[model samples]
Target: MRRDEFRKAFFDASDRVHTYAVWMIRNREDARDIAQEAFLRLWQRCETVATQSARAWLLRTVHRLCVDRIRQRTRRQEVSLSMLPIDSFVDADATTDWSPDGDLRGDVIRAVVALSPEDRAVVVLREVMGMSYGDMGEVLAQPVSTVKVRLHRARKRLRCRLEPLCEKRSVR
Candidate 1:
């Protein structure tokens, strides 16, 4: 791709790529690094990657980078919520239908963070980022059917985990 085309692609997809990284790993600094690395990789391969597919390419790259980061965190035995600031768990502009109540929001964030990385990625991509199953499948390297199943299972798991909290709030 030419410089102007690359610039347009970067401007168009950079925020979405960064947001995906943040939601995947729940660490702003690491997310920024991951976004930068993904963009750098895109730049390296700009000759091959089409401008129309740049966002998807960036997302796929970000997903792999996040998986690697998560694996490294696991290997180091340092995957703890306390390692990141409370605010980093959920973005302020995220489309998650979180209530204004901080406690409930915290509970919801905890439930999401507790999910396995794959499940969390599906949830963020579908629910938060509003990507279609086909797009998600491309980013995740899964079949559309598999993406649907994963998303369904992830939502069910989240509902099961948060049901009690909702019930408690309703009872009060």
Candidate 2:
């Protein structure tokens, strides 16, 4: 990609790429680092990655980096809720009630965090990022059908985990 094209792509996709990284890694600093690294990689491969597909390329790169980071966290057994601020779980565009009495946000975050990295990625890409199945499949390197199945399974798992909490909150 040319300099001008690269600049345009950066302007257009930086927020989305950073958001995906944040949701995947659940650490702002780490997410920033991952986003930087992904953009750097894109720059390095500018000759190879077409400008039109830059966002998808960045997403795919970000996904791979997140998976590696998650694996490292797993091996070290160092994952912690303290590392992920509760505020990061809030969706700016979401219409869900944020009031204290109706807030199951913390429970939702916990449930999402408990998901395996692959499942979490599927959830973040589909539900949070609002990517279509074909786009998600490209990012995940899976078939579209597989992406749909994974998303369905992830949502079901989240529902199962959060249903009790929702019920409890409703009873009060």
Q: Number of the top candidate by TM-score?
A: 2
Model 2 lDDT tens row, 9-53 = 998999999988988888888999999999999988999998888
- Runs off by more than 4 Å, candidate 1: 80-103
* TM-score quality measure for candidate 2: 0.89
Residue 143 lDDT, candidate 2, scale 0-100 = 100
| Clashing residue pairs, backbone N/CA/C < 3 A, model 2 | none
- Model 2: worst 10 consecutive residues (lDDT sum): 94-103
**What lDDT tens digits, residue by residue, belong to model 1 across residues 93-143?**
884766445467877777887799999999989877899999999999999
C-alpha lDDT of candidate 1 relative to the true structure: 0.87
lDDT of each: 0.87, 0.86
Query: Using Cα atoms with residue i matched to residue i, what is each candidate's TM-score against the true structure?
Result: 0.87, 0.89
Please list all clashing residue pairs in model 1, or write none if there are none: none
